[model samples]
Target: MTKISQLDANDGRAELMTDEDVIARIFDHIDNGTTDRGQSSWKEPAVNYQSVDRLDAELALLRHRWIVFCPSSTLEKSGDYIARDAAGIPLIVVRGSDGEVRAFRNACRHRGVQVAKDEGCTSVFVCPYHGWSYGTDGSLRSVPNGDGFPGLEKETRGLVRVDCLEQAGLIFVRQNAGADRSESVPDMPDLIPDSFRVVKSEAMEIEANWKLHLESALEGYHIRSTHQTTFFPVQYDNLTVVEAFGENSRIAFPYQAIERLRGRPKTDWSANGRITYVYHLFPNVIISTFPDCMQVVVIEPLGLERTRQHMFLLTDCAEGGEVLEAVFKGQEFAAKGAIEDRDVVMSAQRGLKSGANDFLEFGLFESAIGRFHTVLKREIEIPAF
Candidate 1:
């Protein structure tokens, strides 16, 4: 196999494999009748996917680590904000008037009600239950009926703060209030950029474990059987370039069109429409590239058997006409393939209840999934302070 180092040692930055490098690996696999593989197959117990205690442990771990919450472009203006639940932690990420990004507990100090709902531009977040207002900076701006409460110092009643960091055009948050407020981040690739604009944003509730949805994006073994009508014709059945950096990994699903570069100059190779790269940003996020748009999917566990997936489709193309139409078409195609994966995962979730097997086996072709589980086990066993 022809593999290239994906990390720059000089600055220790994680970079994607070049288009030419990716093409070479794809060709190498095609000629050798082989795909990326691990040393041995692994079996994961089914109880992890159906245990409430296990779900709680995973949720607690999510609060301690830096997880991608949303794209930075989602909050363009100073007052723009997004309030939602991240792994059961209610958080509001807002751009303060001082032009700095901050995150706080969405709950109001009075009556423990949420101060904001959904997302929008707001100078003040007012609790719908009692009209308690808070500034974008999360200060306790004012409280109604001043005389009803004596010695209610607003300064001491401000919203509790959470750790927040924004880099590479994405926003990340640590829900742990006592978490170290350092600048350390994971080995993340530059997926989002300022030029990319969010064209669609939506949330989905999946009746399966959050990991199930993430496992769907880590391999091309199911492309032919699962995405026959949607992705098989354009992509290879089991050909992929799998590379890992730290705890993160990128699974490249090259399009059949890449064959055109067989004899072309390396300078002429561009990845734009010739391949799809699914970047697993560790833990719970997958940033994938399509021919027309880039999709960021964040998976959140709702319960033992439920999960919430937040999807953002972004594009750098101009608005309207054939170009815009192609973007929509690409989005539709990706959505269809997602539905196919959803159905299969849901079936697997159902199988967990049948007790047909104590453990679910993963083959060598599913090496990325195996790596994910390995990292997850190590993280879960480590103490979170």
Candidate 2:
């Protein structure tokens, strides 16, 4: 029942309202016992979660669109590289000596075996299968035995390159080379400051659909019941300020302590410890802010019922014993909440297979989820073969 303004016209993103503006809106909703609502609700077919054909279409859409590969800070040095599977295709992102970031198909040009297995620093990637070496810039530097093949052109045999863009402290990779190569990365430099450093990272494979995990993060309607013992005591339930930025969205989850800012001057108010800003970058990236660090989660879909989640914890504190101690504590708190949410999503995935309903209903309180489905449906249209 709360009235919110439309997105900004210039940038296609919601305006970054001040702390005072957000706090006032939260209090207004609380006083009226109302929540934000979308233009309308949506009904998604349950089969969309279990159909193999649907999964294929979804993955195809992912390959053609721009997706976040990893945080730019992950590849900090010239030789640093992170390799992983994206949209079912193995990808390697490396920082070149010239300080430019680039992405390439992980497969070697000769035998197609992945040259880079995991994240590490290496001057050149030498394929384990055949000793074919490629430079950090993705050019084929050496083949074990040049005479084995006659008139081999190394320039034409370099590793296949994918479209890559480094923007706003994040690295984005388009899985397929021919997909629209235009650069449209969301502005995130201010949201993720340069001072921040990656302090910790962890990956998990979940037995659930990727979209289900993302839906859990998009709205706070389930916090009271699902995270009653973990987050409900500190953060409100079903209360969020959602804003759209092109295909992406930002949700503000305010803590109970936010009420303390009521008497402070608007200019003096800070969102640091009182509110958590969760930014969703289109297809499958989440950047969340905490008191002392930022948590970045990349949702990589493996199949209709499988997903790989890569999480990174970042902090900006000066190097010191106390700083390390605080960073660990912050990570621990974030991990606990993540575990709680994971359990909820896994259970939802299991229930969806029970044939209890033909369609999964999304109510007004879960408008963000509706918007996510809207975008997904628009992008996953099956083309004529």
Task: State which candidate has the highest lDDT.
Answer: 1
**Per-residue lDDT value at 228 in model 1:** 91
TM-score of each: 0.94, 0.93
State the weakest 10-residue window (summed lDDT) of model 1: 1-10
Candidate 1, residues 1-385, lDDT tens digits: the string is: 1112232211232555787888788889988988877666668888888788878888887887788899888887999998999989899999988888899988999989999889999899988888889999889988889778799989989998888888888999988734456575657667776678777899999998888878989999999999999899988998888877777888899898888888888898878888899988878999999876799889999987788999988888565467668988888888999999999988888888889989888888887788778777766776554
Residue pairs that clash (backbone atoms under 3 angstroms), model 1: none
Clashes of 1: 0
Query: Each model's number of backbone clashes?
Result: 0, 0
Model 2: residues with Cα > 4 Å off, grouped in runs:
1-13, 177-179, 186-189, 382-385
lDDT (CA) for every model shown? 0.83, 0.82
Q: What is the C-alpha RMSD of each candidate to the true structure, in Å?
A: 4.1, 4.0
